[model samples]
Target chain A: MRKLINQKEHFIKDMLDGLKFHDQKISIIEDSIVVRKVKKESGVAIVSGGGSGHEPAHAGYVADGMLDAAVCGEVFTSPTPDKILAAIKAVDNGDGVLLVVKNYAGDVLNFDMAKELAEAEGHNVATVIVRDDIAIDNAEQRRGVAGTVLVHKYAGYLSGHGSNLQQIVEKVENMMESLHSIGMAVHPCLVPTTGEFGFDLEEDEMEIGIGIHGEKGIYREKSETVDKIAGRLLSELLPHNDDNDIILMINGMGGTPDSELLIVTKYVMEALEEKGKTVHKLLVGNYMTALDMQGFSLTIVSHNDELLKSLNAPTESTHY
Target chain B: MRKLINQKEHFIKDMLDGLKFHDQKISIIEDSIVVRKVKKESGVAIVSGGGSGHEPAHAGYVADGMLDAAVCGEVFTSPTPDKILAAIKAVDNGDGVLLVVKNYAGDVLNFDMAKELAEAEGHNVATVIVRDDIAIDNAEQRRGVAGTVLVHKYAGYLSGHGSNLQQIVEKVENMMESLHSIGMAVHPCLVPTTGEFGFDLEEDEMEIGIGIHGEKGIYREKSETVDKIAGRLLSELLPHNDDNDIILMINGMGGTPDSELLIVTKYVMEALEEKGKTVHKLLVGNYMTALDMQGFSLTIVSHNDELLKSLNAPTESTHY
Candidate 1:
């Protein structure tokens, strides 16, 4: 209820306007889509879309080495198929376009519909569904969380290097196989439309395996020490094989302080060391966030030499 | 009470360990201070520090183009004179060293003591105290908040370009004079040592002109819309001049989501336009933040062509 917004209905549009104003490289298309102002070299365009609350996920990644266009919907709601089609048409070059869809029911359906529409218009398009959350039982039905940012980075780097559509798709699919993530929330975020939290819990309790949209977690328990929490998350993320290198990402779920995130990272690193897993690369910040959710997520991607190079490739995005 | 720290006493050190682990470009000095791994050219070394709660401010900004070393203290506590002296000695490369201290009583006293100690050791050192908060009436005694980040960016860029100590000191002083900032908070942040909030507020009320360390604001009033809040903040920042070019920075105070910050930026841009002030550059993020406080701060620096170019200069720091 203490959010800084004009009207609940206009939150997404107003935020996009502010984003375009702050960064001149970004432009607004049809008032619901964000695209880079300057076009990159002719290559496969990387397009992604979802609800509006997970900021710096789609729009903040629109740059020369990142996303070409980002289609945004209202708070915690999927974008319409027409909006997705518009974004695809705006950024697609002769090379083709690829849509990075998270494994959510609404998001998968809408992006698929948009791909069909774009194909009818003589534009080649492909879809890659990311379902990297390890908390769920079924991998196919798992929800994509903060690990999606890593996929975006790999695909964007490959596309910027003039890779064809099939090459980029193959890299993304390989990334999806190795990436894993799990989240725990101490507090539920409020939806702007209703001005109320999606769920409630006691002050001393936390929910494990919570989704980004305030979905119910697998279970709830009393809050424990940071090291214990990190152990729980890492147990689910780290593979059983020993002596593997990883790219570690510690993502703050919007309301957690940076200091606390670093504390969590300390324990996570300690846990990884004990398990004989070496972290080749590390990223710690609010890359993909649930609005005002007080928690954090740990993402681990088993990295080889080629994937590590792709991860280290430079991009001009504001928040990659 | 829901913080992710292991022990309150080890919060600062653990966080620094995590930071060094996350970014290979940063390293720890004397087990308490943070310094960039790569050495800069022979020039004035820029150093800044205060409490440890303000992440990405003093330590996260330590890189080739930013601070050479940052001395960190416990949560909400200033570093001792001995710790500051050690940092001064660690990064001093004969050209001289500049200390950027905020306008808090403890920080000023300790940094001044350290400067005398460094001088006695045959090392030349100078200090610049930043007091840019426009919320209070006594300009000389105003608390240095988020606006100090701008001073750091300017001084660091100049120092990295082989500027002498005098030149960097002059640039930072000019930035301090032209910069002004004001903040508001919806919820008070907790201190790790005490495990209690610094203040309290009702759900329907907000504190205007709040300080970064949970200090009381000028007045408390009912929560209003984003436009009204933006208007109040801008009225205090803008001078009486008809037209002027300024650089606007909308900084989140730790807990506010990026989505909400963008919404706040939209209204702030509108308010500046109404006042006939043109914003040349805009930086929006959590540059300097309190520990889990739900609010934001607005900083305005009246800039000319020279300062604009300096602001846009690239830096190797991870946060800036």
Candidate 2:
């Protein structure tokens, strides 16, 4: 695939620079490549980072009423601890900082190291590892996916409202207890540098519970109707939801239109209603999108009224 | 080409149903297929309508601080006069109503007929046709594209602030006089029922000035760098202006990433800045997108401080 990139290695940096071009309210730290709140931010700062292919996932959500800082790695790869550490320090206020880390192994280790580094510098820090995907064979071993967007939103609410690092971490952990996400892939997206798909699937089939980084999904099947897809996704998530109120997310893999995402949400709502569950909060869009993949995911999180209200809080971001 | 459509004939209705499923405030008229204001619009209600493929074009812009109603038709086809008239009536208050129509042969004719119908009924009405596309051969006969979004935004601001129909029409006409848009397509999009691409281009080439309905562009050549693409698009538009302040819009054609769109916007900014023109506003996203087509369009609209300030006003809509 022909792309408009300067150099394969510089793609991520250039993309980040482009993001900062129009919105002067956002500034990226030179050399370190970390984005921080340009406006004065008080209280605990929430810092999140991940691979860069998901355009609005980690960075676009970093605006007022959301994240304080965001770090980006190369597409589908975790950022080094140094990058994470730089982001943590840039946004660290007197109240300390909280790191919202996803559950991918590379992401977990790197963020954990950064947390230790921040602590060594006398900065009070806490980490919340979001493990929301439910597609793996061992549920305990599944990795994080689209649920990370919710973690950022929920964590941002706590941190933005003056919660300390520890308090914010506790809130995120409580939310994670009932959060589950599952995604499917219609086709593999080509990495710009390689000009080859990250994975491969037949034209008539799709992969379910696929990882964002082109990791193999747990199941492969022929492409089905939106209602059936929603049924399967909800079936996997609703079983463990002990809370009566659920926060549901219908996310696209970047390529689907909002119209289709809403159709997925329609089926999801019907699925929940048939199960006699109350959906307290709902979001359907390309939040936490994969790269040009045509499919949708479902994320269900058990939440209290406070969490529900926080999830729906107003946020100013480029893509939100 | 795998789409989320239920049936070829029911695509528009089903898509609108999906949209209403997400936003409860949107109500679709059954017979007319017109989406109108859920809350009573006290001021002169602003109504807009156009082809259907551009998801969130008209309907997505209708909300608390935006358009009062939007009428829909088949993909890339203008709505019937009956549908447009129904939309105007559904949103019309005692004050009056202003119809914002794009400058296409079909859209202009249909909306004009609707305006006449509404006027014959003794309801105050006015119409403003936006002709902003600069990619066509002759300036006098160019079609409308992304610049229509700016018209909708400004018209929404005026009508929402209680401007009369004549006042709103004057404002819209003035805005249209200073607007120009140009677009390119990397690949052709498929129409659902026929399952055929709207146009054809070589794998290593792109078409400039591609119409919104998958019509042929004026120029076809080997794909160039995004910077060059932006340069070419702005080159055509900048001549129409005598170096005035303008708002810049880099809009995705449904399938491009926000990251890539930002890159395209970067080039557009550089091109405009090189000409010593000031950009008072910048918007980058998938506004007025084709159906999953891989490309983007740039729109420049000259504006005064009033329009600039109004552009930044808080808007609550699904696709703002």
**Least accurate stretch of 10 residues (summed lDDT) in model 1 chain B?**
B235-244
> After best superposition, candidate 1 residue A80: deviation in angstroms?
0.9
Writing each residue's lDDT as its tens digit, candidate 1 over B54-157 gives 78778988886678999998878899999999999888989999999989999999999999999999999999998877778898899999988888888877
lDDT of 2: 0.77
- List clashing residue pairs in candidate 1: none
Q: State TM-scores per candidate.
A: 0.97, 0.95
* Global lDDT scores for all candidate models: 0.86, 0.77
In the range A1-320, model 1's lDDT, one tens digit per residue, is 57778888889988998898777898998888999898765999999979888887778988877789989988888999999999999988778999999999999999999999999999999999989787788888999899888888888888877689998898789777878888988877766778898689787898888888768777799988889999987776665223378888899999899889988988999888887888899899998888888899888888788778877888888787
Model 2 Cα lDDT, one tens digit per residue, A1-320:
44555456777766777777667677878532545447445778878888888878787877877888888888888989998988888887678888888778888899999889989998888887777888876766778888888888787777667777778877788888888888887767767768677888887787888877668887888877767777877777777676667778888887776556655666678778888888777777888877777777888888687787778888776655
Chain B TM-score of candidate 2 stands at 0.95
Best by TM-score: 1
Fnat for model 2?
A: 0.30
Q: In candidate 2, which residue ranges exceed 4 Å CA deviation?
A: A37-41, A242-244, B31-37
Best by lDDT: 1
